[model samples]
Target: MTEEEPRLSAREMIERLDSSLSPGRRVRAVAALLAGLAGAVFVAALWWTEPGPLPGRTHLAFALFTVFCLAWSGYGGWLLTRRVPLFATDRVIAAWIGLAASLTTTTVLAVVAAQRDTGLGGTLLVGGLFAGMALVLAVRARTRRAALLRRVRELTGQEDR
Candidate 1:
């Protein structure tokens, strides 16, 4: 469309003024590619490090890392397909941060279990602390996400969905 043509959407206007038509798509595609490649490399590292040998603390650490990479890869794939707008990326980022925090806590606990004896009291304490923090973060993220959606609706001149 030419400059004289009226763009009906924020996306279209942005694309017209800017150089890219699908900026969000581009960002998501890059993330997906990088995450997928990282996942594959981590899987390979898992095989190389363990090699079906005796499982040790170090192997457990590597396994945790591999799982993290795979999870991120899947997340990236979901993001890529979701087609989130630039303004909405903040909400997505907030959600991802919360998810990463919880995943880290879980992975750390798993690694700890792999390293030493599984103690109920100690595990429960640490788990409870992190779980509470995760809950707080999740609630905050939801608030931010709602605010972001409201802002998007305002910009788009659309009714609340």
Candidate 2:
């Protein structure tokens, strides 16, 4: 008689499926968390410590910037707390969120530069760089997710849709 292989428990199966955390990823996450938190605090401090009264629009801009940084920090915190891996899905979401924030901040900064008769070209150039980087990250995340999905399908002997 042929012997059947032992079945794995749910926890064992999950452990096998989930990828281990890499040092690079851990550093990136922690860096993001620290940078975001620091940026938020710095912006808030600037807004509070301004000597003269600022315009209402300026206040709104500062608030928006602070919130953006907070959002990034919150995302980092969430990533750190995730014990169950969502594969590259979390990365895809993070990239999209980063893209949105980059676009918004870039536009705001460009507008401010133009209003202040500063270097609009330089601002746009830097902003474009950041936006491009975010786009690249999003694309990479999506590609990774797709590849993982394909691997899973192949392993399961399922037909690709």
Candidate 3:
């Protein structure tokens, strides 16, 4: 492992230098891209095709939903086009963003259900599932980021409390 001695074989070096994502990540990227794009388009179409003018709150809700879907599409497209792997910091940020989106969407849905005198229980149940998943992802992402930071500190011999 000395500087004078080669550490990686030719194939290993080439693989490390390759820019493409792994198969699983590629699948995720494509799924995210398609799902987000479809969701955005559907929401936008519904909003546009409504027969009557909506209230200010309804308009805002539609806009928010559209933006959320667009954000996901943009993130997927960015990941697909990037040359480098997503780093720990990026993952942490993404996880937090997801958590926020989940919470916001859940709250909005719950409010709408209550206002419409619909099945609030069903709405909360579904929204809670998504929010819980997002929370789990956020926690996992933070843990992973911390572990990576600790490993880097160990390798550099610069441990800090």
Candidate 4:
């Protein structure tokens, strides 16, 4: 086995490769775009699924949950396919995403707990798990972003920049 050469940055690494992005790359990108659309459609399709009638509030809660999920998914897909660089680095953006997911999950779970006949312990347990994971992710993201910025400063010799 051989170790790959280290490049300064991802862009540099891509430039150094100088290979065609044929076959899977474009297909994969388009697929990614379509996947988001498909996800929204799939979520929307749930409305059509039926075994029997649902209580109005129960159905409304589920609908709100679905909308929130779709919006988050759509935002994620946009981030993935966006050509222009965002103001924040990927890790920072990821931290924001972690926050969004955590808030959404906690809220949705709480709504479900209130609307449905689910056990309190189970709902709290799952909601806690989601919150805990989000906390860990946010902490890790901050650490990584700081490290990355430090490295960039060291490499460029521009500490104040």
Candidate 5:
């Protein structure tokens, strides 16, 4: 009834995105899937290899990484459901990249800690990596989003009409 009301439901949102995807978007999705699969494989390998006893700090780092991934994934899913224009294909690709980076960092730190028997160093490494990755991703996303908004404004003129 309102001019600003959303016309799509959650399922419809996903369907619309899938239907309107460009070739580039499709490629990005495929790349994200591959990256996620690789991450999963790496995690599984870590478990299977049983590198050895881990330090308490490494365990803490793993837990933090798990929590971060869960939170960010949920946020991404919410954005997808809402069908926010700002959450474009590029943003999704970035999210996947961030996820992969976090996973890989956590896994590597855990393995290194186990192998070297140095929990504290592994924990610090994982924490520092997570913080750095998050900051970088946030800045990149914000920059891209700002550029997108500027482009939209240029195309549509002012919204004061």
Candidate 6:
């Protein structure tokens, strides 16, 4: 009599899905927490230290930064937890490009505002926060992809070849 291969139980399937989703979800959660904390800190520091009144332009810039951070962190967290394929190569690349542009433009604007009055530390703090988030997302996506590919290869008995 021929032996049949054992089938995966439902629990095993669920576990696999959880494993695939966990890394990305963790990354997103961390990113969100960092962003929120950083945003609060930036606002507090700006309120305390900035000499002159906050310029309208600076306020606008801060608003933009706040929106971007909240959107990215919230959406990214949702996508990761749901195991959505939102981080395809093209999408990831596009996101990184956007991050770069936002960071650069915000920094420039902040610097200009600071030159007008020496007390705006908000820009530096927020920039660092976003930079850290970008780094975390990039690393998590890359690692997850690599691990998935490796698992596929192992399952197919193609790794050594």
Which prediction has the highest lDDT against the true structure?
Answer: 2
lDDT of each: 0.63, 0.85, 0.80, 0.61, 0.57, 0.60
TM-score of each: 0.47, 0.78, 0.76, 0.57, 0.43, 0.42
Candidate 4, after superposition: displacement of residue 69 in Å? Answer: 4.2
Q: Best candidate per TM-score, number?
A: 2
| Best of the two (5, 6) by lDDT | 6
* Candidate 2: residue 10 lDDT (0-100): 49
What lDDT is obtained when candidate 1 is compared to the true structure?
Answer: 0.63
Q: Report the error of model 1 at residue 142, Å.
A: 2.5
RMSD of each: 6.4, 3.4, 4.6, 7.4, 9.3, 8.0
| Clashes within 3 Å, all models in order | 0, 0, 0, 0, 0, 0
As for model 3, its CA RMSD to the true structure in angstroms is: 4.6
Worst 10 residues of 4 by lDDT: 13-22
Task: Please give, for residues 1-161, the per-residue lDDT of candidate 1 as tens digits.
Answer: 65786547864554444333277765765685587667769676666865466557556656656666666666565555653344445345645654675656566776577567687467667777776776776777777778876876777678998
Extract clashing residue pairs from model 4: none
Residue-wise C-alpha lDDT for candidate 6, range 1-161, written one tens digit per residue: 99998898544543555335456556655676576557656755665577878877667666665555555555545554555333244245435645674576657767786877855687777777777777677766677666765665566556454
Candidate 5, superposed: residue stretches over 4 Å from native: 1-19, 60-89, 92-141, 153-161
Candidate 1 residue pairs in backbone clash = none
- Give one digit per residue, the lDDT tens place, for model 4 in 1-161: 89997657644533354343345544544564565567667766776684589778657755765665565555556555655433235445556655676677677677767777677677778778877887787888778777766765665566555
Local error of candidate 6 at 141, Å? 8.8
In candidate 2, position 82 carries an lDDT of 72
**Tens digits of lDDT, candidate 2, 1-161:** 98999997644665576564578877777887898899999999999999898988689789988988898788778777777666688799789988988888889889899999999999999999999999999999999999987876666667899
Candidates 3 and 5: which is better by TM-score? 3
Tally clashing residue pairs in candidate 6: 0
Task: Give the range where candidate 3 is weakest over 10 consecutive residues by summed lDDT.
Answer: 9-18
Query: What is the C-alpha local distance difference test score of candidate 2?
Result: 0.85
